[model samples]
Target chain A: MSDKGMNLTLKIWRQKDAQSQGKMETYQIADISEHMSFLEMLDVLNEQLISEGQEPVAFDHDCREGICGMCSLYINGEAHGPDRGVTTCQLHMRMFNDGDTIYIEPFRAKAFPVVKDLVVDRSAFDRIQHSGGFVSVNTSGNTQDANALPIPKDDADKAFDAATCIGCGACVATCKNASAMLYVSAKVSQFALLPQGKVEAKDRVMNMVKQMDLEGFGNCTNTGACEVECPKGISLDNIARMNREYLKAAIDK
Target chain B: MSVVSEDTFNSTSHFMGTNAVVQFVLQPILAFGVIFHLSMGIYLDTQNNKARSVKYAMNKPGTNSSWMSRNMKITGIMILLFLGLHFYDFWIPELNTKYIVGDMSGLNEHGGMRYFEELQHKFADPIWVILYVLSFVFLALHLLHGFQSAFQSVGFRHTKYTPIIQKLGNIYAIVVPLGFMFIAIFHYVSQL
Candidate 1:
């Protein structure tokens, strides 16, 4: 760790609300510690703004350790500030050099509207989740033992991989089409893969896809950028699986 | 020969080795594949549009996917429009002369109709030739993204195989359209 801090130029997006037009506001910061997390650097900037009697930039973040999926920003043309397999909070100032101009903006998608500076309404994801992201499980104590089900190793592994999706909307943010196929597919696969959830698999897939389409997202063109930007490293195979499931359900109906 | 329709495009070469098998079975399957692919492309484009009600105020698509991927629907629509004109120019006339008019004598000596002469006649007009060639250009652009994406959509993706598929797709996108364009230009220039 160097004792000297780095100075940087930041071009950040600032908007009072969703209805107002936004623009880039440039600011220069001095002596920023390289060891600081990207969010901490923002905090320093906010502190400076408050001290100067100005309103601080508004952004979304929670569980900075990267699991909660709340921290969302398009940093320097990337979902998480030029980092792979990490969220915005996981990004560090060390990734930038002194005097670098870092551009910060909210994730731009028709489905995801910018509420303020670097925060957008990600409730679209929640609506997709609410559509059909769960299995109808019995809460009764007489429920059958989960361990007794003999799921194949391959299926179990694939299901586990699909379940890791954090619904961060990096998939939507990074996709050229702004498609939520990756996020919706992961949620569908999480339920569709197991025998416990197989009972309502048909409705689960159809309803979720309908909701996704209704949410004003874009279609998956298989550009594969979503998987590249995903912090959890979600596979494109999940989308393929969901497509297959959707087709089967459609045919059955 | 009995099962093969003389009105169908040249099936004499038996590119699949067995003439009887290729003419009777393979040709129809190939036709079906072409029609299904075109129909599916249109259907998917409709779904793609419905997914987004409002357009983004600011979008930097080049940051992620290629321009071809971003504009596939436009390219696909261009190709589809071209196909309609193509079938009207060639297939409809052949069908009319062979089945409706019941005259094979004035048609191409190849059997039902003279495809070679028909092409020569159509390409004689420089405007038709130019439009024909432009359609192939659109076809190439569409194929640039479509060829590899078709494989991915069907779940045929792998690290080693994907690069090979993409390389082959690029070659097919360029070479196939270029080949068709060459044929049109060759006929047009020969007529002049």
Candidate 2:
């Protein structure tokens, strides 16, 4: 790809507040560096907006790296832009052509209401986390030995895979139903597959799933869009495992 | 309930596609998947409703997911209902004819025409034909989401092939249900 700068068109969503009606405002950026990250390009555009005495577009980002799960944007009909398995921060301008008209929109979901322009209030994720995303243990130093327990290799690997979920709303944003099954299942599987998490296993699946439902997210239709757009490449098997856990808990109850 | 209900036991008599490979190996796994999927669906539906205790004043789900994806539970419930009627119509009678009546003549005879005639008989009535067609519509909707979803659930996805899988899913969703609907309509028209 060329490192030369190029002019581009951007269609960004703008809203006054959460209650206000939102619309796509078009802006043109001239000579944006092709090597810049997608968010960096937006930063340059914001700088230009400030210089022009115009309100800058609002968006979300924490770590410039992909790990924090704070960077969320729906770019050109795909979550986190055209790049596969990367968040918005990782999306380089090289992915787009010189004169490309990129459409940037906030993650749309019932559970995720737009707080401003591209920043939606994602605390629905927090409530879900609170609903049993923890393990109970003695806070005192009398904890069990780390190597005391034995975990099967496959189970440990699967648990590690599930634990990589960053609780980003990308799964909900990408889902047609805006369902949080991927996120919830990841949380559930992380605990369900672990011996330490076995203490709250039943309640974990039941409560987390219940809270996820209560967040006004749409049901998972199993379209597989969430997995496709997930930055961490989390598997949908976690969801199946969650279903199994829920079923076992429900039967027991 | 019985470990294997009379319904399931009766249904097993007509496992026509379950050759040695399917019967001995795949059938059990498929059955577990179907049962688990249905049960999980019911629980998930309840949880989904609970999650969205307050409906959004305005929701534009079209922006994110497909229509089939959004309405899977509705279609799934409809399919479950259709399955009950299906088992009643064919599986139960097949069991009765084979075991209860001691007349195995119609059992797997006429190259499975008895089964064909059973379908024709059900579709002959306009009400049944409408119900059958409607069930296929729900079936199509369910399959539209379930087909590709099965692949994703099992952790199989590729940028190069995911689009192809989705396209194939759409084709299967349309063709299979449409084919079943046509069969029902054809039988109804033939009788008329």
Candidate 3:
């Protein structure tokens, strides 16, 4: 725990760009501070690469505080680097030991194509949300009174829980089938649970699910893996709720 | 239990093997269901694999999902292999008698029902017994994730009722395979 930090071996996937092939390249670090966040440790590696006249690794990160949902890496094997309830940015170097061989790769799925070494395109999530991730409220100066609508405590709380999903692709990366059901379900549940989202609930579930399928994500086999690896610990109940919503919407339509 | 008494076994087997409804209606429906399930599973497994064209260098799937849930395709293929052997052992013979050879009499040369003796003769082989028992284990694994999963696919989920269904699914998964295994071992042991 003194000034002599941990010496580590890093196996990182290096890709020139989306079209180029990728491979795991090994690197060595002499002293990595355990207090450094996983992203910060990568920064050290990139800085080392720059000084050595080698190409730096490409990765995604924003809001190092873990709020932006932009940081993504499949560290070792688990998404967000083996820690629970935290994104890769929040993962610390302390989780590993000295001389540990750490494998770092991008969050992978056909829907989330690898843009570079550790950056995958997650715009597929955006497309699904675009279809029906919102409520149609009047904002043309005829806005309704916000406080007038009262949602029950239980329903509001559940909605808030569902709303906490940051649209990260970790669920897809962790899933064996690479299913996006959890992410889609969280969005569907957030809206389907409240009065503001009730009017278009059926159409919302229908369109979002349709878009999700169009994105080529695999079907859910109810493995419950996504829920376990989710950084926000989003409940599997949201998936069940989405199933119910989708079924009802399909039936009524 | 049937192996202990020739008369009891023949009566029960003859009843089931010769009954018009069991032969004509139930068997056809059961056959269709098994074929449909196997085909659908193969189709989905292939499609899912195609979704992930590239493989990961290191993956620890056991950390997040149960082994049974993650390896459905493997267990499913195991069950498929078992079914091929099972149909050869039992269904082929039944088809030979009922349709090809046209012996629906359920009789032996001595003018007695042969169902009990035929059943015993099949289990007399140690290899068949061992293979059948091993297949039942795979069946149990397949059902462990499958039973509740089917309900989930149909969207029959509730806070109070879902947990109950999952528990019931586990019981069903265990008991059905256990029942098959017990009968298999019992028949093989009783013959000696």
Tens digit of lDDT per residue, candidate 1, span B1-192?
212343343333223323557645886898898889878767777666654444343455566667787788778778778878977986576557745877545445555445444556787899988988998998898889999988877656666788899999999999999988887787787767
Please give the interface root mean square deviation for model 1, in Å: 3.3
Better of 1 and 2 by lDDT: 1
lDDT of 3: 0.90
* Highest DockQ against the true fold, candidate: 3
Q: Output the number of the TM-score-best candidate.
A: 3
Q: What DockQ do the predictions score, one after another?
A: 0.29, 0.15, 0.71
Ranking by TM-score: 3, 1, 2
Per-residue alpha-carbon lDDT of candidate 2 for residues A1-253, written as tens digits (9 for 90 to 100): 6667989999888889988888788999999988999999999999999999999999999997888988889888788877788999999998999889888888887788889999988898899999999999896989998578999988899999988988778887777557888998898888888899998999888898888777788776676678888989888778878877887898997
Better of 2 and 3 by TM-score: 3
lDDT, candidate 1, at A67: 92
Weakest ten-residue segment in model 3 chain A by summed lDDT: A1-10
Better of 1 and 3 by TM-score: 3
Candidate 1 lDDT (Cα, 0 to 1): 0.81
Q: What TM-score do all the candidates reach, one by one?
A: 0.78, 0.67, 0.96
Residue pairs clashing in model 3 are none
Q: What are the per-residue Cα lDDT tens digits for candidate 3 across A160-251?
A: 99999998788999998889999999999998999999999999999999999899898899999999888888988899899999989999
List where candidate 1 sits over 4 angstroms from the true fold.
A1-4, B1-60, B77-137, B151-175, B182-192
Candidate 3 residue runs with Cα over 4 Å from true position: A1-3, B1-6
